[model samples]
Target: MRGRKELEKYWGRPYTDTRDWSIYNERLVRRGEFYLSLDFIDHWTDLVSRMNTGKPGRPFHYPEPFITWMAFIHVFLQMPYRQMEGFTRKLSIFIPSLVSADYTTLFRRIKRLDISLRVDPTILSRNVIIAVDSTGIKVTNRGEWMREKWRVRRGWIKVHAMIDIETNQILGLEVTDESVQDDARCIPLLDQVQQHCGREHTIRRLLADGAYDRNEIFNTLEKRGILSGIKTRTDAATRSTGSPYRAECVRERVRLGGYREWAQDIDYGMRWKAEGVFSSGKRIFGETVRATSKEGMIREVKMKMNCYNMLLTMVK
Candidate 1:
């Protein structure tokens, strides 16, 4: 009862609109420019010449930049390859220099196109606080209708990502099968962030939820000198022989009174920025992938995430 009373003492902050309406409004308008930017047309010849140089295949008909542009559109608009083909064909009528690649070409190229995660170098140049989390994206949209009518289950793929808590930008992303566990990906995600930051020491702290409360996680972060803000499980034993780091954290939480107090001190609420990313990503790109093949599904998810990062960069 005393604990309940203590928790009740905390109240939500009053709502405030801190955004610059004029600047924010302009940023949203630029989102449309991503859909139909024609700047690639001007550099079409130069880009194609560069891509074809030292290549032993039939002279490439499309520039790599053009293919990249189409790939971005394919994921952002959630359109099928055929629709993308038609989209290009429609554009080619006015701009004769733009020859439309068929749906087959669009499929093959986008599958192999490298979509790298982008992070602000400024974030990497300083001590960083990172939040890690996983969210599932449906393998196919047909799962719902099939489940309702035929009782079929189409599982989802998990996206494990690490984001800079200060900037809320995704620094690393990995896609795995539905069977993969969240705790298993923690180190790999950290490794990616470490690679981006150029050194492991640049990561000052890591934030995550209870799914990452294992002793191995704490020990690993301790070795890297990264403070762990991972929440401890309610039933976790306060003493552990294997990982003194986790044991000490559990004891500290008790000393501080409870999870709420400990979380407040550590600013563990910042972990939810990862959830916000998932929510905004789903709302923008979608919750379901359109690809039928495993490789295609992975590439599609990466493209969606890359597009998300690009849009965020544009506003800045």
Candidate 2:
């Protein structure tokens, strides 16, 4: 006791304010609040509830913080769970909130999250103009069997997305095997959008490329009483006259050159936005690829997309 006091006396300025000694503590509190306000913690809690894990031990310590840390870590660093765990541990002293879970715990939780969790797209935007497109992601090893025989890649997954043209928010998303064609994926994606927006026929015009130029797609839009602003393909002539719907679209596009140009510009310009979204997702959230099974890969894809949608909701 006397020894410590003597040393303190020798040192001129004794430590008086423990709280004021470091700015990191204050920064940690603010950082945690920022993540919480963005609903990161709430989403993680929801995911954990669905996990229904029966690990049976004393239960993982600080599960909520662990999950929250994992989600934010995935988004910010865009690394796999193993890498994330290592990075966090190495840097844990700098980020107090990240010291909760190790790699295995975090990865197990991520794999347990349900792929079917319904993400509400209406939260992204209410704008009438929506852009639709699909981008490919490499699938897990189990999906290798589904790859096209002629294709060089082993297997791929397609993420069909719809974004608000005005705000660049992701209005809708669907993850499917890469073999699913763009036209085939559209109807379901549209249904999802309709359900979330709660509008019987709110989408005024859908902007898409020539890949969506089929008569059935046009008819689907027509049935919904929504205008299809998708560009008509030139090669469609082979299928145009034989089908009245294709002919009708061609005739309509031919009649309105200005409308055609406007639609093409809108479709082309907005297509890039979807690509930009994917780029941002991969760059910021590490949405690249992972699982070794088809189901796991799909789950991973949906989770990543949901995370993107959540981030969009935050920024908007």
Candidate 3:
């Protein structure tokens, strides 16, 4: 209610004109009754109606801008919903750009919004190379362990990610418990890549460690016309036969003149991108311990993924 003049100043300035500020302003008003006159609020509500939802029902109580703003605060501050709600209220007094909403309302709206996933095709398609890896997040109660060990105790939830070689954008992400094997996680992510690309015969290559060296994984890739650049593991019998899975073999197979040389090269350089995505998720959105029960954990993982997707969309 106090920041109307500042908001007006921001509205009057011209910039890249990428965002539809009129719509953004309307949403801001719904979050709190701004101190502005009725004319401004009316202009915003009219713009909101024209955004084209033909469903006959009450309009969204929390407008789009408010939702977007709440999401931004949630991620930027890395705070829980209640903390975020309190911060928004305090911020609204001096920051005209800020809008405040109740904590319960913010939580409900976040759970309901079905944010779309948007990945750039150019990044995914360039060179047809992908680096696959997985990292862990905590999901269970480990407060006892933390107290005993004098450190943070946590259950692990693994996020398997595939990153583009050229652009370093996350191409795909799949969440599972820490107990799930890496190879099992990779299978669905491969399917996701195919599904998202909308191609039946995209010839992309995957690079990964020996954890993905199973014959089934390789065979699956071969069937899909994708070249597997995963490092090979030596069986005991094969080792006894004097045929070892040597570094040269790996280098040669992934060498410039070899079957998966380019794939290996791309993978080696960009494998850390997947880890970086995990770190960013945890650091920015407090994605550490989500829910206690298995079902709750699954739902929390989806929410975190949604949050990650939204942040990526906003930044890019």
Candidate 4:
């Protein structure tokens, strides 16, 4: 097919030696059992001082830093709560904060927890190029037979996220039930990106798949002066009633050579970096949620993304 041929040609590119970066990233994790332990201690201790966890009766044994950092350890190691309690106790020599909270207290906080694992935007470059995408996250571990034979609907959550394509850093995330469409969240995801990165930070472009081929998405990008690399649906016209940018995109193809040519010109293939977000998140956090309730599932999946983004910061 012509499409297949075009893709093959487009795939060709030069490679650079990124081994040094990989070695450095590994060193970040390799320094201790708690990878980036001191970084976390410094980060969480600062966070705790500002938090309104409030004065507990008779001064609580746990420092907010200890409880919070240990929970992150829970996610990073995928350790069981009880096991992590013991693990933290043993590792307190490195970060004294780890001993402040026991695993039991940590578990209770985790179950009833509301925390945002945000990347510090102040540390980033002002240049922003965002990409948005959504992926299905399984809510249960049950197999296909359970759904097919029993006519049971499988529980699933959808994770919609926007990321900085250049740095592979996630900027914002939204978790929803399976029924929610991808396009439905594009605007909100952009809002989230702006909130996280700050309104003053300029977004240059947004890349997405055909699922984001909506007039609203195009219009929003146009108003913000952001170039859009969203895939147009096969049957969708270049002149849609709602999208003015569609006209520019059509012109882009004609001015260059063809559809694939324009895509290559703009480096639109970088959209897959958004896909990489889903792949890495699932690989690190997991493919399924262990929570039984909808709220719990949403929180777990959202936190998974948050922690995943935090890991991205470590590589910096």
Model 1's lDDT to the true fold? 0.84
TM-score against truth, every candidate: 0.90, 0.65, 0.64, 0.82
- Give the local distance difference test score of model 3: 0.61
TM-score of 1: 0.90
lDDT of 4 by residue, 169-201 (tens): 778788888889999999988887777877667
Best by TM-score: 1
Query: Taking the tens digit of each residue's C-alpha lDDT, what string does model 1 give over 197-219?
Result: 88443888899998898889899
User: Backbone clashes in each candidate structure, one number apiece?
Assistant: 0, 1, 1, 0
lDDT of each: 0.84, 0.64, 0.61, 0.74
Error of 1 at 37 (Å): 3.2
lDDT of 3 by residue, 1-316 (tens): 5376774464443334465888667654543332121233334455466643684766554466566556545544446888877876886787554446789988777766554344656434534667788877766545665658876645577877776555455667777777788888788887776666665336477777778876667667766767666766533122223323334344455446443454335455355566676676777556565456775566566556655554444433
Worst 10 residues of 4 by lDDT: 31-40
Residue 194's lDDT in candidate 1: 88
- Per-residue lDDT of model 2, residues 1-316, tens digit only: 4576775675433546455535645543544343444233335555455444776655454345456546655655557778877776776576554344678888777666554534445454444677788888755343445556645465577888887666566667788887788888888888876766675326777878888877778778877877767777754563445456666766666655644354544454555666788887767545446667777767777777766665555443
Off by over 4 Å in 4: 1-58, 89-103, 111-114, 145-151
Higher-TM-score candidate of 2 and 4: 4
Residue 213, candidate 4: alpha-carbon lDDT? 81
